[model samples]
Target chain A: MVTVHSTSPHFKANARRALGDEQLQRALTNVPGGFIAKRQHAKDKLPEFDALRDEARDLKNHTLAHLDVYLEEYEARVIASGGHVHWCETPDEACRTVIDICKAHDARTVTKGKSMVTEEIHLNAAMQAAGIQPVETDLGEYIIQLRGETPSHIIAPAVHLNKDQIEADFRATHTHLPADRQLEEGAQLVNEARQILRQKYIDADVGITGANFLVAETGTSIIVTNEGNGDLTQSLPKAHIVMATIEKIVPTLEDASTILRLLGRNGTGQEFTSYTTFSTGPRRADDPDGPDEYHVVILDNGRTGMIGSDFQDMLRCIRCGACLNHCPVYQAVGGHAYGWVYPGPMGSVLTPSLIGVDQAGHLPNASTFCGRCEEVCPMRIPLPKMMRHWREREFERHLSPVTVRYGIGAWAFMAKRPKLYRLATGIAARLLKLWAGKTGRLEALAGAGGWTRHRDLPAPQGPTFMAQWKRRRP
Target chain B: MSAREAIFARLRHQLAAGSSEQDRRETASARIAGHAANLIPARAQIDHGAQVKLFIDQAEAVQATVKTLASHDDVPDEVTAYLRKHNLPQAIRHGTDAQLSGLDWHGRAPSLTVSHGPADPHDEASLSHAVAGVAETGTLILTSGPDNPTTLNFLPENHIVVVRAADITGTYEDVWQTIRATYGERQMPRTVNMITGPSRTGDIEQRIELGAHGPRRLHIIIIEN
Candidate 1:
């Protein structure tokens, strides 16, 4: 079961706490060599990857624009295929709908595929509270679930846990099994999980999975996974439930195909995942095997408010997880530090909107705006621009601290007037130079405790880049 | 209720507080058109042999096995030779393509117990063929046909896929167009499986595993000119 961390006063504190975590820090340090390197290799092979991304972005934009039409079409197709569609306005309604269905079906055990929407709604805990067992079948999710922790990464849910920690967790949890087993190896851990989950898949009364894309024309839910566990989860169960956000809808299978091409290449640098399964409906009478019933619960949960707004581009997200994989903040602190189901560039923009700005205002401010996220985004979401919009909203509502507001206001005032900006920058440089002494680095600063806590803050150079450029031109 | 009525009701409710109806309609229509245009390529064609060769090159580059067979009759012999060469056990569950039915599998490989189609997780090897091979991404599109079940491509240790010289396409768009033309607007096939190479993931410690959850080894047999 997934637990929602108490994020009200302690999110930043927890993130700072996480920064001190040696194990998490070691795991996160591998992101650059892992996702970034693989992506570069994949991109190097496909010179037309950027062109494909542009096309995919355009496609997503087009789909979001006509989302209503496509959603209706998709709903029609789903109904025609004998699947029930439930529209939910909030996370509570979505969770209630799922619970009601499970109750109606007399379901006790629900085997789940990895679903971000389920995470968003906090479904597993709710199900367990209702006296039902919702087992997360994805290896990573299962590991985290056993640990009673939420996912710390989008793609790899247990990214924060080292092999030793996992080994310990397994040993503690699987007391029936032999202790002192060689659980340090990755494959051995995978095999151990496979043995445990294989039984859950067969015995599951109900199966639930998230849709990567919902094709309105075909009324199909497209699930792309390297593991075929998703297919097993859906196929072997008596009932299958797809919990997807309303924004996941695309117009047709063809459109889904275009997005599929982008999904793997961006997420994990694969040409295609091992299993890109498309399930249209419950089992046909003639069909050898499949679920007897299927339900697709489309959760709105403040997304409609975002539509046609500056943040509307966020709905185009395919959940390829490129942003999380490449994000410096996420790479440093991991997902739990963000204190939400969604994390990284997309999460920073989204979590605040869904949960309310007051609760999650710090998310948007956690970025350096380095543009690497925007550079790697498959849908080409103007993430920094959206983040700035959130910042502006936060400021307008007086959510930002008074000191930050005054400092930013002063900076903005100086920036508007070039002369004042130059003078202010000159004075700041002089002050920094005086503070620096003969050496260029400052070990600590009086007001900048947050900046100095992690690493050294470099002292300002002789002049700004703008001033240097002007001097060179003149 | 009619799909149109349901859609309109939902739209009206969603846009009740904000945005004009005309604006919403225009935006919706434009978005639909754009998504459709992106999906439907103007020029989508099937380029057979060259595309197949490209797929083979990609599979080989990823450290997978690639071979060619002269005809369907050569399949059982080829299978036996491959198993023997790899030093695999003789008692293996054989998943055969529908085209292979023409060949006398019982007479050739008497000891082999053949499962006509599909494969269970316990199976050692699953053999099938490509419906269309896309050159752009080096992907093999394997739809659920009479001879091929989608499970065979996934639920096994080793996947041996057969690709005819005639069924290769240049791009994904080309493959989609073919699929549309083949299936029309009727009830489509239950599944359309696309396999690129061997199943892989680098999630744990950034180390790439050949088979994380699906087939560990992917062997391609291209029947060429």
Candidate 2:
């Protein structure tokens, strides 16, 4: 139900607007609440957590190395269990397949769980265009849906909104209720959404959800959720459709357990999510109540290209959002500035790969390279190095802005001649010091107004690093 | 080529990892058949008593209330007492699990009304017997069957689960092993739900709130006997 135009190409403008919007600035203050501390506590408690991460990474590696066979095996197992597998090479095929399933089922209203793949394919938009109404069941997802906004955070879809903003949205949408009802507390808001969505769950003809992991060994799609909405959404419907990327596969239940050990700890610092459901086929003949139809739509939207490329290591990501939480840039500007479904360090490398570099070249350059993301990544993805790779790609293709290209060209020319570089830097450093006579800081610097506009840049001290090093060593 | 064929072809082109397709299929099948458990945490490798203690501790850590009963007979009393203590409704819904149906609710807790079926939206409480409990994360493994409907785990305000002490395992690996032994390899029930605690969400300004579209309170009754 989220509406997104993906202003990713205008990331700088989005960030500028985000930084200035007082409401968004107020919301950004809440982005870093105890996530870092909570993850650290969990890591300290479990000594084998890192070891389990290594094992999980290796298992995913093994699966990807033989991805073709695993996909075939998974398909066979799903079919054997009385489910259908729809292979989709692009987002269009995936969306079409989902819409076809809904139309076949005569689904007027379909309930959905929080799924990034569905977001990737714009499934809700597709379904809406096909005259099928989609209802988001996750509380966070529902909030964002009511407001007609994309998910700011993967796990917490409504992370960008304050409670008051949500209250206003609820008042506007739930107009049938009394005009002066008290929706004051978080619990009250949750209960209100719960009461409203309960009927939608039962009324839904088909339920769609994203898989956290697709186990080939048992032909099961696993979903981990703190809220139990996914269970209700899938259980109460007549049909269940699982939309997932091909990379979310583990060879066995044991491999899934290894990944499970890291997902929760890195994501929300919980030892485990409240519910981890492994759904195989639809309701069996003897089953009292469950969906009658089960379908798994496997999507490959540019992931096939990342298989053997330099960005291949990114596929190991479990979508934990730890990188987002630890990213300084993400904390400063929040998710909307990245202008897409995914944001932060992982998005920096992944956005360009999914949508070409020319459209999202700014995402990679937005990082401070603090290396916090790679440190906290459960899969040990080298995010900063990959961002540098994207920067290199941008430069090679001349995708970077004219100013940036010229600046880099000037710097590279001086760097190739070390003596000239030292002389130029020495003179510039002294000139900067003279310019910053008494204050020891420049209010504005030429060619870098973006940096000095809001905060003062510290003027250069005495001399360049090379000059100081030469005098000290000699 | 169809999307399936194109995807396969693309994968083949990218990952022609110096082996024939037959060899890759063999490698994958072997791995799946082997089904290895990679690492078991030290916390989960403990004695039975320690494991039970740890399970209780971890479950309570996640805000799930727990109590050890002498037997199933005591469950009726415990369930009634919990309902009364919390000032909840005196009725509970459950599937046709033998452990629950066998409890002499008529004889012991006369006021507690019990019903059998999948949970309805109006049901205030639901009960099911867990197939296994993992001590590593204080998780209960509930496999869906005709008698143990999956809806009972959700759709209710309060969920009461009964897990026998003997079924408690040290890690999720043990639970999966038991499942494989019970269900046979590569076969499972419609759904296998591993529930750690009551439904919760931190979506509202990252503030923790329980009972988000699922049971608000999860009361576990362990059969110590």
Candidate 3:
């Protein structure tokens, strides 16, 4: 029932198209202007921020090391709290399980919060195919859903859109509203959406959400959102279905707090989101208002393969999108250029791991290896190192394009012999310098159009780094 | 094999260390039961009075309005003033939460009409009593029961919460400890809502606009005497 559609194989074309899109370029400015400085300010305010990151990393590492037992314990707790736990090995199976649950409840319309896991499994399409309406309650998600496009950013789903584009989309879809009504300001758009969705939340039969963390100690699923859509989505419906991956488990509330310290500060630069709701199970006997049935579907979807692979550390990702915020490669081309469910440095490593390097090889190659992603990662994931691992895999499998293979082959041939490497680099540096003709930039390179197409490639100012190192040391 | 078993098998197979299954179970249980605290922010390790001041400062920084009253008895006066100042409805929807219901709203402000139960669709404002307030993030912790229905937190256009100054703690860890003690070991209320500021979204061009879906205004009443 769930089909994963990917354009990763055409990542180059996607990146090129994204670069030429003027509206996207305008929208992308929000990345550095908004996220980077906010994260820095939040980090600077707390003296123990780095120490908490270390604790968060250690907690995830410990949890992953004994993942099986911890998951077993977590399931038992969920059952004890009067919640159903469904284990799924694939996205299709997870989708099928959800459809069955909805059918059991005779649900016609299901409201949803912002959940990356559901996006990963393409839950909306599957639900639509089954004749169920999946209403996105999050303002960002609702905008993109109206446009019939996938999320371009993880945390900010509609970040790639400008106000004009959004206003146009609203006018086109919300025909019932006054056609000429003012929707110029951000608050106006928000208020309009609130008025429209308020009735949908009350009419929804089932609500599906993604958990930020699942506590093994008490079987609670927690969601942190600046908007309280996730709370209303789950609280008003007859049944609450939680769609989550297996790796989202933590040991206790204390551990969740440790990670929370980093998640908001690093992700949105807030101390905490507006609502961090912890739901244990179905509504209790005396509860006046809440869902009667609670179900949690634990998905694997090839992540179990990552458990012991070189990419196992990727499981520690909390989907903060800070890497996307800090990644230069991601900033230049935007997330749509990455061509998948996830798009960033973390995606560069993870996309290939989930869907083979042969198909997603361009993702790893997209990085500048500035090491900013790893530096900013709250979980301390070595993203550049993992991307390098994928590059090696791509080369070994002979899946890389022939030109890239030969370029690396020739470079490796020289790199092995130190004298020849220095000689070859020295000659090329001088050739490039001579070709510059005092302009100090190259308009184009013969075989590497990708390097010089957007901006002039800066000419080497001096000899190769190795040659300068030897001269200075000697 | 069942999907659950297969998934678990693959995980254990991939992560097959030398430890026995029993050993891993022991480790997990010990960890869950221990409920150990990690490195808490030094900002949260202050005295109660400082914590209270920090709570107010932190809460206000996030755009939540905080007003401290001498006692819970003065809550009705402030609520009426707030509702009138904003020109909101002369009524509020609230739950049967004792701390809120026990207040003398009828006597103190006869002009203001207050009702109880889960939130009504057209309600302009709602009120609740927070179990605790975390000073570090200026977040209020509300447990869902008949006392404070979860819907009251998100269903209205404006939300008002009253927290006793004594209940405000310095860290989320302190709140967790209190939860464990009140709910009994490893048990919790059906829902525990931790609210910070009001509803907001940066989804539109990354410009944060308040009141995306929930309340636009979050007014906090801290009883200090």
Candidate 4:
């Protein structure tokens, strides 16, 4: 069982530790392993990629606007197709419904596809506490599961570890294998885990997966994956459960196609994932294979409040992790430093909404506002704007520190008076130059010791911009 | 209140009924019923021969093997040859798909054994007939039913799919249209599996290793009938 003890409030502390950890720094260096280049290649292949992104964003907006109608229609179709739809307003209800389903079948073992929603709800812990052995079939999720850790990255859960770390994990867990077997390469580790999980797939009594999109037109739940773990997890089990949030619902299959064109290309830079499965319900009576029972659980959490609010655009997110891949902050600190299930720009905006700003105010403040996340987003979500919104909410709610409030208040005070602002900036620039000496840098400072502790801050070299402009004109 | 009712009520309250509630409901239902295609890529708009070429190119780009045969009778021989070349067993598990059942396996590979129905725990290879092939991404659409068992597509180490040349379409929109015509717009099979290549994972240090859980090798046999 994995527990989400979020260290989000201690983001600065986590980041400080992460920066100095040699192993983590080495792992983080491999963060840009062909992701940016591959995404560019995929984009180059499809000229309509941007146009498709626009359509996708608009489609999501339309669907979310009428989410109630689409959800209702989707529920009816699922029931008509011999499946059950369970609406859960909270994570506890979602976990209870899953456990109840497993208990009804007396499931001893349950296999799972990679699902962030399940991560958000901490379903594995609840299931394990109920005495059900939940096995993560995805390669990345499986590694993290063995280590009893949550995912560091949304797409690549184990991206924070190297092959050596994974090899050690495999050796420590798989005792049945021959001693001193050469488990050095990535291929060898993948093969070992594949052989170990194949038996678990057949042994499981129930399987739970997350839906990439739910089609209200045909009551279909779609999942896109490069590995076929999700298919095997759901197909072999006696009962299959799809755990999804309400925003996952789309109006029709065509709406799904609009987004599908962008999902793989943006995430992994593949034109399409190896497997894009659309499962409507349980197996037919005449079918030779498939789960006999199918259930769909729709969790709301706080998404219902997101609609018609300032944060509504954030709902267009497809969980592709493109923003995370391109984020400079994520590349430096890695995901765990963000201190939550989600990290990077998307996490910056979403974590606060899901877990309250007071608990996660540091996340929105962690960004450099480089806008790379927004530029690369398949849905074109205004991530920086949303982060700014979260900052505003934090400030309004008095969640920001006193120092930050005082600094802002002082800056706002002079900004209204241009003459005073110019005078203060001119004086500060001269003082900074005097303090910098020949090095032209500030190795230490009185008020902001935290900034200069690790690296020297560049001193202001000349007069302020306003002073220079006035002097040149005169 | 029940969770469902509460959720709906909250959403309604948040939406605040900007327009007539009846109008919003109608608009939602209308969009689902219409289900129009939006922004079909120009790459998938080529002619038939070019479409097949594009499909083959796309499939190969994703690390899948393709074989074009003049008839379905060549399927068994090709399957046997693939197995022999790879040092795999000459056993294939398959479902009741008519296109697959009509093939003469005994004539081409007399020593090969065939298992009918879903995949067993030890099946080395499996065969299924693709309902349609999308040329845009070289995606094989397999609708799950008695004819094509869902398990056969994922459990085996090797997967071979047979698709009629006429069934290969230009885009996903065309395939969706065919599905709508056959199963109605509001209905679908229990599972519609769109397979582009064999299973692979980039989890271990972001390195791609084929056959993570499903078939390590994906072989496509397109009948040019």
User: Which of the numbered candidates is closest to the native, going by highest DockQ?
Assistant: 3
Can you tell me which runs of candidate 2 are displaced by over 4 Å? A1-4
lDDT score of residue A448 within candidate 3 = 67
Query: What CA root-mean-square deviation does each model show from the true structure?
Result: 3.7, 1.8, 1.4, 1.7
Worst 10 residues of 4 chain A by lDDT: A1-10
lDDT of 1 by residue, A1-474 (tens): 123343733567878888899998988877776778777776676655677678888867766656676677778778888999988776777788899988988988999999989988899988998998999977778888998988877777887877788888889998988886788888888778767877787788999999898876678888888766787788777889999987888766666777776787788877666667777778775554567898999887778777757788888888878898888888878888888888888998988778877877888988999998999998889999999999999999999999999999988988899998888888888799889887787889998888888777889878877788989994
TM-score of 2: 0.98
lDDT by residue for model 1 over B99-171, one digit each (tens)?
7666687888876667754456567787787777766556678866446655566666677777776776776
Docking class of 1: acceptable
lDDT of 3 by residue, A1-474 (tens): 236588989998998898889999999999999999999999999999898888899999989988998888888888998999999998899999999999999999999999998998999999999999999999999999999998999999999999999999988999999988999988899999999999999999999999999999999999999989999999999999999999999999999989988999999998788999999999999999999999999999889898878898999999999999999978888888888899999999988877778778999999999999999999999999999999999889999889888989898888899999888889999999999978999999987686787689888888999878878994
iRMS of every model, one decimal? 4.0, 0.9, 0.8, 0.8
Please write out the lDDT profile of model 4 over residues B1-225, one tens digit for every residue.
999999999998877656556767999999988998889999989998889888999999888999999998888899899889899999998888888888788888897898899889889999999989999999999998888888999998999999988899998888889988999869899999999989999998787899999999999999998
Q: Write down the worst ten-residue block by lDDT for model 3 chain A.
A: A1-10
lDDT by residue (tens digit), candidate 4, A1-474: 123457899999999999898888888776686578788899999999999999999999888888888888999999999999999988889999999999999999999999999999999999989999999999999999999998999989998998999999999999999978999988899999999999999999999999999999989999999889999999999999999999998898888998999999999999999999999989988988899999999999888989988898999999998999999999999999998889999999999888888889999999999999999999999999999999999999999999999999999999999889988888998999999999999999998798899889899989888767878994
The CA lDDT at B211 in model 4 is 93
Worst 10 residues of 2 chain A by lDDT: A1-10
| Model 1 chain A weakest 10-residue run by lDDT | A1-10
Candidate numbers, best DockQ first, in rank order? 3, 4, 2, 1
Residue pairs clashing in model 1 are: A74-A216
> What's the CA error at residue A427 for candidate 2, in Å?
2.0
Error of 1 at A401 (Å): 1.7
The DockQ figures for the candidates are: 0.33, 0.87, 0.90, 0.89
